[model samples]
Target: MLEDLKARNPHIAIYPVSDARFSKYGKVLDGFDFNQCLDIMQTRPIPEEGNCYVASDAELMGTDVAGELSRRFYAGMPVQIGYCNGNSSKLNALEYHKGSEVDVAVTDLVLLLSDIRNISHNELSSESVEAFFLPANTACELYATTLHFAPCKTSSDGYKSIIVLPAGTNAGLDSIPAPKCEEDYLLWMQNKWLIAHAESIPASKGAFVGITGDNIEINY
Candidate 1:
């Protein structure tokens, strides 16, 4: 599957999550049973047009593994279990949270990732991004400084992935606070800092236009 994806999208390099190149951004997780959660996610519908992101879902969180995730994966930190299902294929934007994020790929997908250190004056060049492939049923943890967004689909079936994060990470903010630094401009929701490409939907909604260069599209 990885080879097929590579052949289909020859213009960009897509490394598997197991590759050393992925270590700096995140690590492939092991030893946690995601069967129940993934089974539930498989039943959720993917949006016909764009992405459907639920920051919190009771059904997913009700799985028996949820308690274990909180105790082990998150070390007792309160967390939320949600899902992002979509047909996205572009590097529309990048977002980071105050804490690490865990993703469980329900289907094969691609992720565009970069380091927060690459940001210069609150702006990041699309050139700094790297593509990584997440095979079906794989789980990985993305560090707090790792910049990421929606998983790009590798097939017409679209993508489905479980999103685990500190509770309230992407919940709406009641009010906007005065900006104290350039990074403040990128704060779009609670614990979520976003940098959007000029052509992205977030940009049209007034998210900080911080991504420059091409809005990369995955041909596969």
Candidate 2:
């Protein structure tokens, strides 16, 4: 399936986490016990077609890993535990926040990434996007400048990963002050400024839809 994907999208190349390009943005976490988090994921139901779950702050009352992450990685910055599990392939949108995000891959998956600095006028060229392969049972920190969204499944079983971020990263944005500029169009959610491809589902939901180029889809 990977070979087929490459054949169709020459620009799309999946790199291992150890690649130097990844070093500039994130790193793999060694010696972390992800069993407890994976156990909780096994209890939830992941979607078959697209990303379906996201708890912006599951750590508040969810798992012990959250506290561990805060103390060890977040410097006690009141982190939150969340999860994104689904069977998705398209690069629908790209979003970023004020700080780094840690992702524990309970299952093998592919993450689409791009440097937020490449975006201009609230729009980003798809040509700048890249794909990175995240192996199962590994955790990595994605820096704030990295634009990313859901993990694409590498197989039919689908993908499941634990997401760690600052508290209230994805909370409701109904109370945010009104948009004042073009960049504000990307503020669909709190702490998340998004640029969605026109063909993406979020575009229909009134997302900024500032991404230009084909809506990338990974072959499974």
Clashes by residue pair, model 1: none
State the displacement of the C-alpha of residue 159, model 2, in Å, after optimal TM-score superposition. 0.9
Give the lowest summed-lDDT range of ten residues in model 2.
53-62
How good is model 1 by TM-score? 0.98
Clashes of 1: 0
Scanning candidate 1 in windows of ten residues, the lowest lDDT window is 4-13
The local distance difference test score of each candidate is 0.93, 0.82
Tens digit per residue, CA lDDT, model 1, 144-164: 999999999999989999999
lDDT of 2 by residue, 1-220 (tens): 4455456556688888878989866888885677888777777677756677676535323577777877888788887777888988889999999899989888888889999898998889888888888888889999998999888888778888888888888888776568798777788777888899999888998888888987888776
Considering every candidate listed, which one attains the maximal lDDT?
A: 1
Off by over 4 Å in 1: none
